[model samples]
Target: MIEEEPRLSAQEMIDRLEPSLSLKRRVRAVAALLAGLAGAVFVSALWWSEPDPLPGRTQLVFALLTVCCLAWAGYGGWLLTRRVPLFATDRVIAAWMGLAASAATTTALAAVAVQRGTGLVPALAVGGLFVAVALVLAVRAHARRRALLRRVRELTGREEK
Candidate 1:
Protein backbone atom coordinates (compact mmCIF):
# COMPACT_ATOMS: atom_id res chain seq x y z
CA MET A 1 0.00 0.00 0.00
CA ILE A 2 1.23 3.46 -0.90
CA GLU A 3 0.94 6.23 1.67
CA GLU A 4 -0.32 9.68 0.61
CA GLU A 5 0.94 12.82 2.31
CA PRO A 6 -1.52 15.48 3.40
CA ARG A 7 -1.38 18.87 1.73
CA LEU A 8 -1.68 21.97 3.85
CA SER A 9 -3.32 25.17 2.63
CA ALA A 10 -1.23 28.30 2.40
CA GLN A 11 -2.84 29.78 5.47
CA GLU A 12 -2.36 26.60 7.42
CA MET A 13 1.29 26.48 6.40
CA ILE A 14 1.76 30.07 7.38
CA ASP A 15 0.16 29.41 10.75
CA ARG A 16 2.45 26.48 11.30
CA LEU A 17 5.51 28.49 10.39
CA GLU A 18 7.20 31.44 12.04
CA PRO A 19 5.06 34.48 12.84
CA SER A 20 7.70 36.86 11.52
CA LEU A 21 6.92 36.02 7.93
CA SER A 22 3.46 37.56 8.07
CA LEU A 23 4.75 40.57 9.91
CA LYS A 24 7.46 41.12 7.38
CA ARG A 25 5.04 40.85 4.49
CA ARG A 26 2.64 43.30 6.08
CA VAL A 27 5.45 45.75 6.68
CA ARG A 28 6.63 45.41 3.12
CA ALA A 29 3.15 46.04 1.79
CA VAL A 30 2.77 49.19 3.85
CA ALA A 31 6.11 50.45 2.74
CA ALA A 32 5.25 49.81 -0.89
CA LEU A 33 2.01 51.74 -0.55
CA LEU A 34 3.81 54.66 1.01
CA ALA A 35 6.45 54.67 -1.70
CA GLY A 36 3.82 54.55 -4.41
CA LEU A 37 2.00 57.48 -2.85
CA ALA A 38 5.21 59.46 -2.73
CA GLY A 39 5.95 58.70 -6.37
CA ALA A 40 2.48 59.78 -7.41
CA VAL A 41 2.90 63.03 -5.53
CA PHE A 42 6.23 63.70 -7.13
CA VAL A 43 4.88 63.04 -10.60
CA SER A 44 1.90 65.27 -9.92
CA ALA A 45 4.20 68.07 -8.86
CA LEU A 46 6.27 67.71 -12.01
CA TRP A 47 3.16 67.77 -14.15
CA TRP A 48 1.89 70.87 -12.42
CA SER A 49 5.19 72.74 -12.61
CA GLU A 50 6.09 72.44 -16.27
CA PRO A 51 7.58 75.83 -17.09
CA ASP A 52 8.03 75.22 -20.80
CA PRO A 53 5.64 73.66 -23.25
CA LEU A 54 6.56 70.31 -24.72
CA PRO A 55 5.71 69.15 -28.23
CA GLY A 56 2.55 67.09 -28.50
CA ARG A 57 4.34 63.85 -29.11
CA THR A 58 6.81 64.50 -26.32
CA GLN A 59 3.99 65.33 -23.96
CA LEU A 60 2.19 62.16 -24.92
CA VAL A 61 5.27 60.09 -24.32
CA PHE A 62 5.81 61.68 -20.93
CA ALA A 63 2.23 61.01 -20.00
CA LEU A 64 2.53 57.39 -20.98
CA LEU A 65 5.72 56.92 -19.03
CA THR A 66 4.18 58.54 -15.99
CA VAL A 67 1.19 56.25 -16.25
CA CYS A 68 3.37 53.20 -16.55
CA CYS A 69 5.43 54.11 -13.50
CA LEU A 70 2.35 54.78 -11.44
CA ALA A 71 0.71 51.59 -12.56
CA TRP A 72 3.74 49.50 -11.74
CA ALA A 73 4.05 51.08 -8.34
CA GLY A 74 0.36 50.58 -7.69
CA TYR A 75 0.58 46.99 -8.77
CA GLY A 76 3.44 46.38 -6.38
CA GLY A 77 1.30 47.73 -3.57
CA TRP A 78 -1.60 45.54 -4.61
CA LEU A 79 0.50 42.41 -4.87
CA LEU A 80 2.02 42.85 -1.46
CA THR A 81 -1.36 43.59 0.06
CA ARG A 82 -2.72 40.30 -1.25
CA ARG A 83 -0.01 38.42 0.67
CA VAL A 84 1.02 36.63 -2.47
CA PRO A 85 4.44 35.01 -2.58
CA LEU A 86 6.72 37.80 -3.79
CA PHE A 87 9.50 35.46 -4.83
CA ALA A 88 7.45 34.64 -7.94
CA THR A 89 7.30 38.20 -9.25
CA ASP A 90 9.43 40.56 -7.19
CA ARG A 91 12.66 39.58 -8.91
CA VAL A 92 11.17 40.05 -12.35
CA ILE A 93 9.89 43.48 -11.38
CA ALA A 94 13.25 44.40 -9.95
CA ALA A 95 14.98 43.33 -13.15
CA TRP A 96 12.69 45.41 -15.37
CA MET A 97 12.91 48.35 -13.00
CA GLY A 98 16.68 48.24 -13.12
CA LEU A 99 16.61 48.31 -16.91
CA ALA A 100 14.09 51.12 -16.98
CA ALA A 101 16.18 53.14 -14.53
CA SER A 102 19.24 52.60 -16.66
CA ALA A 103 17.44 53.81 -19.78
CA ALA A 104 16.10 56.87 -17.98
CA THR A 105 19.51 57.75 -16.61
CA THR A 106 21.06 57.38 -20.04
CA THR A 107 18.44 59.60 -21.62
CA ALA A 108 18.83 62.30 -18.98
CA LEU A 109 22.58 62.24 -19.30
CA ALA A 110 22.40 62.50 -23.08
CA ALA A 111 19.98 65.38 -22.82
CA VAL A 112 22.25 67.26 -20.44
CA ALA A 113 25.27 66.65 -22.62
CA VAL A 114 23.42 67.98 -25.64
CA GLN A 115 22.24 71.08 -23.76
CA ARG A 116 25.76 71.80 -22.56
CA GLY A 117 27.34 71.18 -25.99
CA THR A 118 29.56 68.55 -24.37
CA GLY A 119 30.78 65.32 -25.90
CA LEU A 120 28.42 62.37 -25.59
CA VAL A 121 31.11 59.71 -25.42
CA PRO A 122 31.48 59.88 -21.64
CA ALA A 123 27.75 59.79 -21.10
CA LEU A 124 27.37 56.83 -23.42
CA ALA A 125 30.16 54.97 -21.62
CA VAL A 126 28.70 55.60 -18.21
CA GLY A 127 25.22 54.70 -19.39
CA GLY A 128 26.53 51.49 -20.87
CA LEU A 129 28.20 50.58 -17.59
CA PHE A 130 25.00 51.24 -15.67
CA VAL A 131 23.02 49.12 -18.09
CA ALA A 132 25.53 46.32 -17.84
CA VAL A 133 25.34 46.34 -14.08
CA ALA A 134 21.58 46.34 -14.18
CA LEU A 135 21.58 43.42 -16.56
CA VAL A 136 23.97 41.47 -14.35
CA LEU A 137 21.86 42.10 -11.27
CA ALA A 138 18.73 41.13 -13.16
CA VAL A 139 20.29 37.91 -14.32
CA ARG A 140 21.40 37.12 -10.80
CA ALA A 141 17.94 37.84 -9.46
CA HIS A 142 16.37 35.46 -11.97
CA ALA A 143 18.88 32.79 -11.14
CA ARG A 144 18.18 33.15 -7.45
CA ARG A 145 14.45 32.97 -8.04
CA ARG A 146 14.86 29.83 -10.07
CA ALA A 147 16.96 28.22 -7.37
CA LEU A 148 14.52 29.18 -4.69
CA LEU A 149 11.63 27.83 -6.71
CA ARG A 150 13.47 24.59 -7.18
CA ARG A 151 14.15 24.34 -3.47
CA VAL A 152 10.47 24.97 -2.78
CA ARG A 153 9.43 22.26 -5.20
CA GLU A 154 11.83 19.84 -3.61
CA LEU A 155 10.54 20.58 -0.12
CA THR A 156 6.96 20.16 -1.28
CA GLY A 157 7.78 16.98 -3.18
CA ARG A 158 6.36 18.51 -6.35
CA GLU A 159 7.50 17.17 -9.69
CA GLU A 160 9.52 19.43 -11.89
CA LYS A 161 8.09 20.43 -15.23
Candidate 2:
Protein backbone atom coordinates (compact mmCIF):
# COMPACT_ATOMS: atom_id res chain seq x y z
CA MET A 1 0.00 0.00 0.00
CA ILE A 2 1.31 3.44 -0.90
CA GLU A 3 1.70 5.82 1.98
CA GLU A 4 -0.01 9.16 1.54
CA GLU A 5 0.92 12.53 2.88
CA PRO A 6 -0.87 13.55 6.03
CA ARG A 7 -3.69 16.09 5.64
CA LEU A 8 -2.76 19.26 7.47
CA SER A 9 -3.55 22.94 7.36
CA ALA A 10 -1.10 25.04 5.36
CA GLN A 11 0.36 26.66 8.43
CA GLU A 12 0.70 23.30 10.16
CA MET A 13 2.35 21.79 7.12
CA ILE A 14 4.81 24.66 6.99
CA ASP A 15 5.58 24.47 10.70
CA ARG A 16 6.19 20.76 10.47
CA LEU A 17 8.31 20.77 7.34
CA GLU A 18 10.52 23.79 7.91
CA PRO A 19 13.24 23.43 10.50
CA SER A 20 14.06 26.26 12.88
CA LEU A 21 16.75 28.52 11.51
CA SER A 22 20.00 28.84 13.39
CA LEU A 23 21.47 32.09 14.65
CA LYS A 24 23.98 32.24 11.82
CA ARG A 25 21.27 32.01 9.17
CA ARG A 26 19.14 34.62 10.90
CA VAL A 27 22.12 36.95 11.16
CA ARG A 28 23.01 36.43 7.51
CA ALA A 29 19.49 37.29 6.41
CA VAL A 30 19.45 40.47 8.48
CA ALA A 31 22.86 41.51 7.28
CA ALA A 32 21.90 40.99 3.68
CA LEU A 33 18.76 43.04 4.00
CA LEU A 34 20.37 45.85 5.96
CA ALA A 35 23.57 46.03 3.97
CA GLY A 36 21.76 45.90 0.68
CA LEU A 37 19.45 48.73 1.70
CA ALA A 38 22.31 50.84 3.07
CA GLY A 39 24.40 50.36 -0.05
CA ALA A 40 21.59 51.40 -2.37
CA VAL A 41 20.77 54.48 -0.33
CA PHE A 42 24.35 55.56 0.09
CA VAL A 43 25.19 55.15 -3.57
CA SER A 44 22.21 57.18 -4.65
CA ALA A 45 22.85 59.87 -2.08
CA LEU A 46 26.52 60.13 -2.89
CA TRP A 47 25.89 60.57 -6.57
CA TRP A 48 23.15 63.10 -6.09
CA SER A 49 25.06 65.11 -3.53
CA GLU A 50 28.30 65.32 -5.46
CA PRO A 51 29.33 68.93 -5.98
CA ASP A 52 31.01 68.20 -9.29
CA PRO A 53 28.88 67.80 -12.35
CA LEU A 54 28.45 64.16 -13.40
CA PRO A 55 27.85 63.09 -16.97
CA GLY A 56 24.50 61.53 -17.90
CA ARG A 57 26.15 58.16 -18.52
CA THR A 58 27.70 58.26 -15.06
CA GLN A 59 24.30 59.06 -13.61
CA LEU A 60 22.83 56.03 -15.37
CA VAL A 61 25.56 53.75 -14.08
CA PHE A 62 24.95 54.91 -10.52
CA ALA A 63 21.22 54.29 -10.91
CA LEU A 64 21.83 50.79 -12.23
CA LEU A 65 24.11 50.03 -9.31
CA THR A 66 21.43 51.17 -6.89
CA VAL A 67 18.95 48.84 -8.56
CA CYS A 68 21.41 45.97 -8.27
CA CYS A 69 21.68 46.40 -4.52
CA LEU A 70 17.91 46.84 -4.25
CA ALA A 71 17.43 43.53 -6.03
CA TRP A 72 19.64 41.85 -3.45
CA ALA A 73 17.64 43.45 -0.65
CA GLY A 74 14.45 42.11 -2.20
CA TYR A 75 15.98 38.64 -2.36
CA GLY A 76 17.04 38.82 1.26
CA GLY A 77 13.58 39.95 2.32
CA TRP A 78 12.11 37.03 0.39
CA LEU A 79 14.51 34.65 2.09
CA LEU A 80 13.47 35.88 5.53
CA THR A 81 9.70 35.54 4.90
CA ARG A 82 9.06 32.39 2.92
CA ARG A 83 7.13 29.81 4.95
CA VAL A 84 6.58 26.94 2.55
CA PRO A 85 8.32 24.92 -0.13
CA LEU A 86 9.61 27.68 -2.35
CA PHE A 87 12.57 28.67 -4.51
CA ALA A 88 15.98 28.89 -2.91
CA THR A 89 18.70 31.42 -3.65
CA ASP A 90 20.07 31.32 -7.15
CA ARG A 91 23.79 31.09 -6.36
CA VAL A 92 24.95 31.85 -9.89
CA ILE A 93 22.94 35.04 -9.98
CA ALA A 94 24.12 35.92 -6.50
CA ALA A 95 27.72 35.42 -7.51
CA TRP A 96 27.31 37.59 -10.58
CA MET A 97 25.68 40.27 -8.50
CA GLY A 98 28.58 40.15 -6.11
CA LEU A 99 30.98 40.56 -8.99
CA ALA A 100 29.08 43.53 -10.32
CA ALA A 101 28.93 45.19 -6.91
CA SER A 102 32.60 44.55 -6.23
CA ALA A 103 33.57 46.04 -9.56
CA ALA A 104 31.46 49.14 -9.05
CA THR A 105 32.67 49.70 -5.50
CA THR A 106 36.31 49.17 -6.37
CA THR A 107 36.13 51.49 -9.35
CA ALA A 108 34.46 54.20 -7.33
CA LEU A 109 36.95 53.91 -4.50
CA ALA A 110 39.88 54.02 -6.88
CA ALA A 111 38.46 57.04 -8.62
CA VAL A 112 37.92 58.82 -5.33
CA ALA A 113 41.46 58.10 -4.19
CA VAL A 114 42.85 59.51 -7.42
CA GLN A 115 40.60 62.54 -7.40
CA ARG A 116 41.40 63.42 -3.80
CA GLY A 117 45.15 63.32 -4.49
CA THR A 118 45.45 60.36 -2.11
CA GLY A 119 48.05 57.74 -2.82
CA LEU A 120 46.74 55.26 -5.39
CA VAL A 121 48.64 52.25 -4.03
CA PRO A 122 46.45 51.66 -1.02
CA ALA A 123 43.22 51.95 -2.96
CA LEU A 124 44.54 49.68 -5.69
CA ALA A 125 45.53 47.08 -3.11
CA VAL A 126 42.07 47.02 -1.58
CA GLY A 127 40.36 47.11 -4.97
CA GLY A 128 42.55 44.30 -6.26
CA LEU A 129 41.57 42.11 -3.32
CA PHE A 130 37.84 42.61 -3.96
CA VAL A 131 38.21 42.02 -7.70
CA ALA A 132 40.14 38.84 -7.03
CA VAL A 133 37.44 37.52 -4.73
CA ALA A 134 34.74 38.36 -7.27
CA LEU A 135 36.68 36.59 -10.00
CA VAL A 136 36.97 33.45 -7.88
CA LEU A 137 33.24 33.49 -7.19
CA ALA A 138 32.45 33.90 -10.88
CA VAL A 139 34.75 31.02 -11.77
CA ARG A 140 33.23 28.77 -9.12
CA ALA A 141 29.68 29.61 -10.23
CA HIS A 142 30.56 28.70 -13.81
CA ALA A 143 32.13 25.44 -12.73
CA ARG A 144 29.24 24.49 -10.45
CA ARG A 145 26.77 25.23 -13.24
CA ARG A 146 28.69 23.03 -15.66
CA ALA A 147 28.90 20.21 -13.14
CA LEU A 148 25.17 20.29 -12.48
CA LEU A 149 24.43 20.21 -16.20
CA ARG A 150 26.74 17.23 -16.58
CA ARG A 151 25.05 15.41 -13.70
CA VAL A 152 21.64 16.00 -15.23
CA ARG A 153 22.81 14.58 -18.54
CA GLU A 154 24.25 11.53 -16.81
CA LEU A 155 20.99 10.84 -14.98
CA THR A 156 18.94 11.13 -18.13
CA GLY A 157 21.45 9.02 -20.14
CA ARG A 158 21.31 11.79 -22.66
CA GLU A 159 24.64 12.73 -24.14
CA GLU A 160 25.00 16.20 -25.56
CA LYS A 161 25.00 15.47 -29.29
Candidate 3:
Protein backbone atom coordinates (compact mmCIF):
# COMPACT_ATOMS: atom_id res chain seq x y z
CA MET A 1 0.00 0.00 0.00
CA ILE A 2 1.16 3.55 -0.82
CA GLU A 3 1.65 5.85 2.13
CA GLU A 4 0.09 9.32 2.12
CA GLU A 5 1.79 12.41 3.52
CA PRO A 6 0.18 14.01 6.52
CA ARG A 7 -1.08 17.58 6.13
CA LEU A 8 0.00 20.28 8.53
CA SER A 9 -2.50 22.40 10.42
CA ALA A 10 -2.75 26.18 9.98
CA GLN A 11 -1.04 26.74 13.32
CA GLU A 12 1.77 24.49 12.22
CA MET A 13 2.09 26.47 9.02
CA ILE A 14 2.26 29.71 10.99
CA ASP A 15 4.88 28.21 13.28
CA ARG A 16 7.04 27.25 10.32
CA LEU A 17 7.96 30.86 9.49
CA GLU A 18 11.10 30.75 11.63
CA PRO A 19 12.43 27.25 11.13
CA SER A 20 12.33 26.33 7.49
CA LEU A 21 13.52 28.25 4.46
CA SER A 22 10.57 28.86 2.22
CA LEU A 23 10.74 28.56 -1.56
CA LYS A 24 10.24 32.29 -1.86
CA ARG A 25 13.35 33.01 0.17
CA ARG A 26 15.47 30.70 -1.90
CA VAL A 27 14.25 32.19 -5.17
CA ARG A 28 14.78 35.72 -3.91
CA ALA A 29 18.32 34.99 -2.79
CA VAL A 30 19.27 33.58 -6.15
CA ALA A 31 17.62 36.42 -8.04
CA ALA A 32 19.28 39.04 -5.85
CA LEU A 33 22.70 37.53 -6.42
CA LEU A 34 22.11 37.58 -10.14
CA ALA A 35 20.96 41.18 -10.10
CA GLY A 36 23.98 42.28 -8.08
CA LEU A 37 26.24 40.58 -10.62
CA ALA A 38 24.43 42.30 -13.47
CA GLY A 39 24.77 45.72 -11.81
CA ALA A 40 28.50 45.21 -11.35
CA VAL A 41 28.83 44.24 -14.99
CA PHE A 42 26.96 47.33 -16.18
CA VAL A 43 29.00 49.69 -14.03
CA SER A 44 32.19 48.08 -15.25
CA ALA A 45 31.07 48.39 -18.85
CA LEU A 46 30.45 52.12 -18.45
CA TRP A 47 33.77 52.58 -16.70
CA TRP A 48 36.29 50.70 -18.85
CA SER A 49 35.29 50.16 -22.49
CA GLU A 50 33.93 53.56 -23.39
CA PRO A 51 34.70 54.75 -26.95
CA ASP A 52 34.36 58.44 -26.06
CA PRO A 53 32.77 60.61 -23.44
CA LEU A 54 29.03 60.17 -23.81
CA PRO A 55 28.11 63.25 -25.87
CA GLY A 56 24.59 64.27 -24.86
CA ARG A 57 22.10 64.74 -22.04
CA THR A 58 19.66 62.10 -23.23
CA GLN A 59 22.23 59.30 -23.29
CA LEU A 60 23.33 60.24 -19.80
CA VAL A 61 19.80 60.20 -18.51
CA PHE A 62 19.08 56.78 -20.00
CA ALA A 63 22.27 55.29 -18.57
CA LEU A 64 21.53 56.68 -15.14
CA LEU A 65 17.98 55.32 -15.18
CA THR A 66 19.18 51.89 -16.30
CA VAL A 67 21.51 51.62 -13.35
CA CYS A 68 18.79 52.70 -10.98
CA CYS A 69 16.41 50.09 -12.36
CA LEU A 70 18.95 47.31 -11.91
CA ALA A 71 19.69 48.33 -8.36
CA TRP A 72 16.00 48.46 -7.52
CA ALA A 73 15.49 44.98 -8.97
CA GLY A 74 18.17 43.70 -6.61
CA TYR A 75 16.51 45.43 -3.70
CA GLY A 76 13.23 43.78 -4.55
CA GLY A 77 15.03 40.48 -4.24
CA TRP A 78 16.13 41.39 -0.74
CA LEU A 79 12.54 42.10 0.23
CA LEU A 80 11.44 38.68 -0.99
CA THR A 81 13.65 36.80 1.49
CA ARG A 82 12.42 38.55 4.62
CA ARG A 83 10.22 36.82 7.18
CA VAL A 84 7.20 38.64 8.58
CA PRO A 85 3.95 37.75 10.26
CA LEU A 86 1.02 37.06 7.96
CA PHE A 87 -0.85 40.18 8.99
CA ALA A 88 2.26 42.36 8.72
CA THR A 89 3.76 41.01 5.52
CA ASP A 90 2.24 43.74 3.37
CA ARG A 91 3.62 46.49 5.58
CA VAL A 92 7.05 44.90 5.66
CA ILE A 93 7.14 44.45 1.90
CA ALA A 94 6.07 48.04 1.33
CA ALA A 95 8.74 49.31 3.69
CA TRP A 96 11.42 47.37 1.86
CA MET A 97 10.17 48.58 -1.49
CA GLY A 98 10.32 52.14 -0.27
CA LEU A 99 13.82 51.64 1.03
CA ALA A 100 15.02 50.17 -2.25
CA ALA A 101 13.40 52.98 -4.19
CA SER A 102 15.15 55.54 -2.03
CA ALA A 103 18.48 53.83 -2.56
CA ALA A 104 17.96 53.77 -6.33
CA THR A 105 17.02 57.43 -6.33
CA THR A 106 20.17 58.30 -4.45
CA THR A 107 22.28 56.36 -6.90
CA ALA A 108 20.55 58.03 -9.80
CA LEU A 109 21.19 61.48 -8.32
CA ALA A 110 24.85 60.69 -7.90
CA ALA A 111 25.11 59.59 -11.52
CA VAL A 112 23.37 62.70 -12.72
CA ALA A 113 25.59 64.96 -10.70
CA VAL A 114 28.76 63.30 -11.95
CA GLN A 115 27.71 63.23 -15.60
CA ARG A 116 26.28 66.73 -15.77
CA GLY A 117 29.39 68.31 -14.26
CA THR A 118 27.03 70.48 -12.23
CA GLY A 119 25.92 71.21 -8.66
CA LEU A 120 23.85 68.85 -6.52
CA VAL A 121 20.60 70.77 -6.70
CA PRO A 122 19.28 69.42 -10.00
CA ALA A 123 20.31 65.87 -9.22
CA LEU A 124 18.65 65.90 -5.84
CA ALA A 125 15.41 67.35 -7.16
CA VAL A 126 15.04 64.78 -9.96
CA GLY A 127 16.07 61.83 -7.82
CA GLY A 128 13.77 62.85 -5.01
CA LEU A 129 10.85 62.98 -7.42
CA PHE A 130 11.61 59.46 -8.66
CA VAL A 131 11.81 58.12 -5.12
CA ALA A 132 8.53 59.75 -4.15
CA VAL A 133 6.70 58.21 -7.08
CA ALA A 134 8.11 54.77 -6.32
CA LEU A 135 7.00 55.03 -2.70
CA VAL A 136 3.46 55.83 -3.74
CA LEU A 137 3.32 52.80 -6.04
CA ALA A 138 4.66 50.55 -3.31
CA VAL A 139 2.00 51.70 -0.88
CA ARG A 140 -0.77 50.99 -3.35
CA ALA A 141 0.51 47.50 -4.07
CA HIS A 142 0.78 46.75 -0.36
CA ALA A 143 -2.80 47.72 0.22
CA ARG A 144 -3.97 45.31 -2.47
CA ARG A 145 -1.88 42.46 -1.09
CA ARG A 146 -3.25 43.06 2.39
CA ALA A 147 -6.81 42.90 1.16
CA LEU A 148 -6.14 39.61 -0.65
CA LEU A 149 -4.60 38.09 2.44
CA ARG A 150 -7.50 39.21 4.59
CA ARG A 151 -9.94 37.49 2.28
CA VAL A 152 -7.87 34.30 2.36
CA ARG A 153 -7.84 34.32 6.14
CA GLU A 154 -11.57 34.73 6.27
CA LEU A 155 -12.14 31.77 3.99
CA THR A 156 -9.70 29.56 5.89
CA GLY A 157 -11.14 30.58 9.26
CA ARG A 158 -14.59 29.60 8.14
CA GLU A 159 -13.32 26.20 7.10
CA GLU A 160 -11.76 25.63 10.50
CA LYS A 161 -14.80 26.72 12.47
Compared with the true structure, model 2 gives a TM-score of 0.57
Best by TM-score: 1
Backbone clash pairs in model 3 (N, Cα, C under 3 Å; residues 3+ apart or in different chains), count: 0
Expressed as tens digits, the lDDT of each residue in 1-161 for candidate 1 is 99999998755553343332367656765665677667777876777688677666456546655665676577567756554454435656667776887877788778778878998889989998999988998888887667756665655667332
Can you tell me which runs of candidate 2 are displaced by over 4 Å?
1-35, 38-65, 77-89, 158-161
- Quote the lDDT for 37 in model 1: 68
- Which lDDT values do the candidates have, in the order given? 0.67, 0.70, 0.60
Estimated TM-score for each candidate: 0.65, 0.57, 0.41
Clashes (N, CA, C under 3 Å) per candidate? 0, 0, 0
Ranking by lDDT: 2, 1, 3
lDDT of 1: 0.67
lDDT of 3 by residue, 9-116 (tens): 765654443323457655655666577667757766665576666667546655655565566566556556556544435345545655575766677667668877
Candidate 3 wrongly placed segments (more than 4 Å): 1-40, 48-104, 107-117, 158-161
In candidate 2, how many Å is residue 34 off?
Answer: 5.5
- Position 67, candidate 2: lDDT: 90
Ranking by TM-score: 1, 2, 3
